[model samples]
Target: MRWSNWADTSSVCGIEVAEPAATAEVSALLREASEHGRRVRPIGAGHSFSAVARPVDLAVDLRRLCGVRVIADGGGRVRVGAGIVLGDLNAALAAHGLALPNLGDIDRQRLAGALATGTHGTGGRLHGLASAVTGLTLVTPDGQIHATAPGDGLFEAARISLGALGVVTEVELATVPAFRLRAEEGPEPLDAVLADVDAFVASADHAEFFWFPHTRVASTRRNHRVDDGGGRPLPRWQSHLSDHLLGNRAYELVNRVGAARPGWVPALNRLSAATLGRRTYTDASAQVFCSERSVRFAESEYALPRAAVVPALRDLRAWFDRTRAAVTFPLEVRFLAADDVWLSGAQGRATAYVACHQHVRGGFADVFAAFETIMAAYDGRPHWGKLHTVDAARLAELHPHFEDFLAVRERCDPARVLTNPHLERILGP
Candidate 1:
């Protein structure tokens, strides 16, 4: 069967798909694949837009190794199988009165995929989702399952290694007590939003903004943590209309229209901006953090120094105007605290994430390349799971612990059993 990622941007064909139910089985498969000179790639939910998870010789679909393995004390630590869906894991954790502290809006990714690609949510003090990982069980090139934790160089390297290190079979996450969130969303002028971005980022527990290109307006979302279910959530029908109908279906239709008439992008963005009004509700933290994202798009995101965020946005806007790019998708801006993980985008520095998207109908080469140049100017690091052309040379320059991560990769997989062409491009041959 042909294997393709969710956005259909990355695909690999004529490859063997393996479903090993147990860790030992995974080890055995690894040994077998290696002996036969076959490359093994573990495929998760296929949510990544990049070829980070694309299989060359064998695609080990780990969904078979699903579910929570252990829920450690009320201290809120849970060990989960790598292939468990983030949504399902949230549901399970909710049952135990525990929850992940932060999560990206799209929860369709499997745990392994989410952590591998450095998937994240928006918050000034919060780091990417993978920062929650306290330990992980990694299957080495030699078919040995090794569990790693902090302090050891292996733990840091394995956390966000982009699947170039090994197969992540189990992840131990440090969770938080189940909490509630009060979500407030409204439209604000893009210029006004950027003017006091630092204050805006600091005031809310989580803050993010989306600015449709060629439009003066930005839709801002701020979610605050609460002691209790802060207030009533939206009624079922209201939610259906707001989330399913307007967010996905209507948005998709707008993109379709924009794709057909490139010149109409400015008008469509204005109308889209006008349609977004104020919305407020309170729900479980997980419910408020994750959103329905059925509309497919190809994206490229980069992590910049927190201080460079407003400047970068200003430059991007200038580029959009100068080139008169026919872009209909809004630019997404978010923030994260610095972390110690070896390859995390926000590593060792406060970060602001900027992501641009293009509807899947056509390739985003021109704009994506422009954006890449813009990001490169700000010393930004590309998100692993997103689209980019940066290779090992520039990457080594961007990441301080680059050589350290390479040392660990060599130690863990000396034969390069866990690599593919794309990884070879980013991590070196």
Candidate 2:
């Protein structure tokens, strides 16, 4: 069989694949593969952009092991199968008047895929999805099932192991009561926007900005929590027009044009940023946080110290001028609270996430490499699921608990059942 991830950046051929419906079935499959000296890679929905899911021997598909299993702690939390897609998981949570603490803009990822990749949403005081996990059940390569909680020695590593430790079978998430967000979005000058970064981060429950690479304007968002019980969602017609039509289709068409000339990118970006304009609405937190994203692109994102964002972005702008690279996609900037997860990008301090994107047809090497170089000065950590060239030696220097994570991985899967070339490159052989 052949497999490819969502962005089509990574692919693999001639792999054995298995989809086990129950935990016991997974254990048996792992043990069988282990005896044959066949390594196993567990993949969920193929949403990651990186090669973390590229299989070396057997691709253990987990789509069948999905959906909510139990609601506990008086329904404030949910224990769900790892393979449940985020869109479905959100709906399931809504039915119980509960929701995950945060969500990234894209919701097509499976629950396990999101957590393992350290997927995060935007908020100064909020951490990534893995941080919301209070407990988890992992099936080691040796076919042993072990459970972990927040204080457990292995808990930190299990949350965002990047599929290096074991396969996550189930997750116990601490959810918040369903809430609503009042989002005010509009364009602002880049200078004015960056100058008030601290005030902006402190004022909103969630905030983000998108600056078209060649333009001076930025689309700013301030989403504040509102108590008016889950106010009205966007009208279906308006939502369809703005989200599906303009957000995805129109954006795709513009990128197609940008691909051909590349020289016309700056003008096109200004037009898009100017025309996107302003809008305000109140909706369920999930609805407000996530938007449909169908236009495929390769991306590189780095998490930097909160104070370093402005300087890094400034350097990026200078690089663009120096290289005159014409990029059409907006540079997205977001914030997150510190997390204790061993491999989390935001570990140990408040962080700002800056992401750069390029249409599939356009050249991205120079820009991606440039930003990677710029972000490095701030001790940046790459998002595990995104594009990055950092290796284990460099990574070990960035993460505080680097050795501890390796120690855990060594003990859990000493036979190296859950590793591939990519893990070897990034986490060492």
Candidate whose lDDT is highest = 1
Model 1 TM-score, all chains together: 0.98
lDDT of 2 by residue, 1-429 (tens): 999998899998899899898888888888888888998898987877789988988988788878695564445878899989999999998988888878899788988888888999999999899988989888888888888888776788999988888888889988998998998889989998888788878879899999998788989999999997655677899889988988889989899999887889888998889867798889988999988889999899999999999998899888877776878899999999988888999999899999999887787888888889999988999999999999999999999988999999999889998999999999899
Considering summed lDDT, which 10 consecutive residues are worst modelled in model 1? Answer: 66-75
TM-score of each: 0.98, 0.98
- Residue 81 C-alpha lDDT in model 1: 86
Clashes of each: 0, 0
Check candidate 1 and list the clashing pairs: none
lDDT of 1: 0.89
lDDT (tens digit, per residue) of candidate 1 on 169-205: 8889898889999989999889898899889899799
